[model samples]
Target: MTLHIYNTLTREKEVFKPINPENVGMYVCGPTVYDFAHIGNARPVIVFDVLYRLLKTLYPKVTYVRNITDVDDKINAKARETGEDIRTITERTAAMFHQDMAALNAGNPDIEPRATEHIAEMIDMIERLIENGNAYEADGHVLFNVPSMPNYGALSRRNMDDMIAGARVEVASYKKDPADFVLWKPSDEDTPGWDSPWGRGRPGWHIECSAMSRKYLGDTFDIHGGGHDLVFPHHENEIAQSCCANKTDKYATYWMHNGHLMVEGEKMSKSLGNFFTVHELLEEVPGEALRFYMLSAQYRSPFDFTKEGVREAKATLDRFYTALRQHADIEADDVAAPDHFVAALKDDLNTPLAISILHELLSAFNKAPSPQTKGHLLACADILGILQQDVEGWFTQNTAADATEVDADQIMGMIEERKNAKANKDFATADKIRDDLDAMGIVLEDGPGGTTWKLK
Candidate 1:
């Protein structure tokens, strides 16, 4: 089956055909490094990560570019408000972003370009826009002319009235039109600035992505992705600037957007106390569990992240790992993922359906454990980027349980003692040991295969 993606540009599921099959290019707008990434920020990171893995499996070469917005007014404002150095804030926050995404099993992009590093490219693109009459400079600032591009709001489908209403709050006296956005703005002595034709000023947010993507993926590319909230001003502006400067009818061939996320049916916000960073959640549940839980819903649908849902996801992974534990002795044969599973993923990354197929594989393996069945089960999980941890590690190295508080090796010793006592027909000692293990939240199971223990 041909892979289909729900393109935000076309507002429909379209069959994905890269401009060049030998190499596939995908660019996703990344975080502006001013603060910790919230759960909302993680949605696109994970959604695209799954897509990235899928692309790698299909194409011989895949170049995934996710840029970092290191130079922004928000970062400067954060420095000013906190009295922290701008470099320190961006460096610290960027490091945290990488750590958090790594925990989610999101691979580092093939090319991670920084906005600050591409200042020259941004200036070049801005200059091209000026020569093309799509942008004009006034009052130490260069702003893109909203009226210059007739189809400016095509992607967002916002008319001039809508754009005016949305952009009214940020209107500047130097702007020719209310909808015109900053391509370059003057930075004060205290703020981070780069020397440009517009004097000592930093590049605007939308222009950063355009310039960076052009430098890496060329003027036109395969796919551009980000969160649904960015469909308006941010993405819309990028399209106008890039297409106008490059003299192309299209900027990106396809656009992909993941829906917003809510916390327990409420909007996730710091004000409501529901905002959670990935690091904070990692303290409560395994990263794999959180990753699995996020894919429970389709990428385009809004997700309600609940504490209970995460716990259930963790338990579900435990069951899958238990099947692996039971068949550990069997040498799994190398096998391809099931066609049905691949078909599910290809159908717009229908992970909920794909996960159902995984459960079917799990159920089949539980009934009859064999090398072939085990390999097939794992192959499916590999595509989903789950169930890779060794079975013993799944039980012993869980974040839900404080490994420091309960030593897994110590619990194994107790189970061994119980086994020896039972063999000696010392029923009293065996029963006492069982009771002690139970009190410690470790449940023991005895069968023909001897004893296996798991946390309650």
Candidate 2:
């Protein structure tokens, strides 16, 4: 099947033709570690992760690069507010990011570069941009010359007048134009700094990505992805710096962006009391359910997150798990996924359509409990990064926090006792144990494999 992607650059859905078919490269902008990653931050992580998984399956070699912005002003401010060392704050926050993404079943990128490690590259690119007459250094601050690139607003399609009128970006006293963005800025003695020709300063947020992407994926790569919000000055500035410095019109061949996330038909905000972190949501629903919920909508559509939505997602997964439970004795066929499932994903990563295919596969598995159907069902789940855990484990997992409640082990022990009673022809005792378990909120299913239980 021919792969297709909706390019944010051209504003159209086009067939995906990689620059180098032998070596496909994709770069996704990662989190700037200052605090726990909220639900909005998770959208692109999960979206591009599915894309990464798809690329790996189709290509012989794929390099996925995601950079960590560990050297940001937010990290410095967080250190000051918490009275913790800067390194301590960034290190802890980055580790938590990895943990949270892992819980959501996101695989590690092939190249996970950090901004602090790529400072030299950033400095080199800044110098190149200066030589190419695309940037200027003023007042110990280096800024990209927006007017230098005639196609500055091409990606976002905004004229200079429109940007100046609608833009809320700060205009510094030293900037030649209000549209010019920072490449490097002076760092206070208390903050992290790297000595450069411009004096003690740190690279700007835009330059960090430009340098890192060039270092890992060459001056130009196949695909660049991130949240839809980064299309403005962040990605636009990266395009200017990288293309100007590298002497190329095209930096990344394809631009893919996931849409924004909302909560219950409104934008999520801490002040609005609708704010939620991925870590907090994981406490209520399994990470698998959250991942599934995010994929229910296409990548480019605004997703309205609701508690009822997550619960429904969890219940839907329960249906898939129950199908597998009924056929536990038959191992999942280790084979390729159905063609229709792959086709849906290839068509601009239409996950809602892909998930619909998944349900069809589930129905097929329910109709015929054979290895081929089971394998197709599971192989498709692998592409979506769901239903990876054991079927028995899915039913046994206890997320409800009530110390007084019976655990999975005790419930299983009761099942085993009932099995023994039935074997000894003590039908009355076996029925009583089943009744007791039901009263404790455990629903038992007797299948070809054995008795499995799920909480009501």
Q: What are the per-model C-alpha RMSD values against the true structure? A: 1.7, 1.9
Clashes of each: 0, 0
TM-score per candidate:
0.96, 0.95
Candidate 2 minimal-lDDT segment of 10 residues: 397-406
Each model's lDDT = 0.89, 0.90
lDDT by residue (tens digit), candidate 1, 1-456: 999998888899999999899999999999999998888898898889989888888999999999999988889889989999988999999999999888887779999999989999999999999999999999999999989998988888878888778755386898898888999999888878989987999988999999999999998899999999999889999999999999999999999999989999999888999989988888778788889999999999999999999999999998998878877888887998888898898999999999999999899989988888889888888878898676877776646535436787788898889989989999999999999988877788776688888767
Question: Which parts of model 1 have CA positions greater than 4 angstroms off?
Answer: 167-169, 398-404
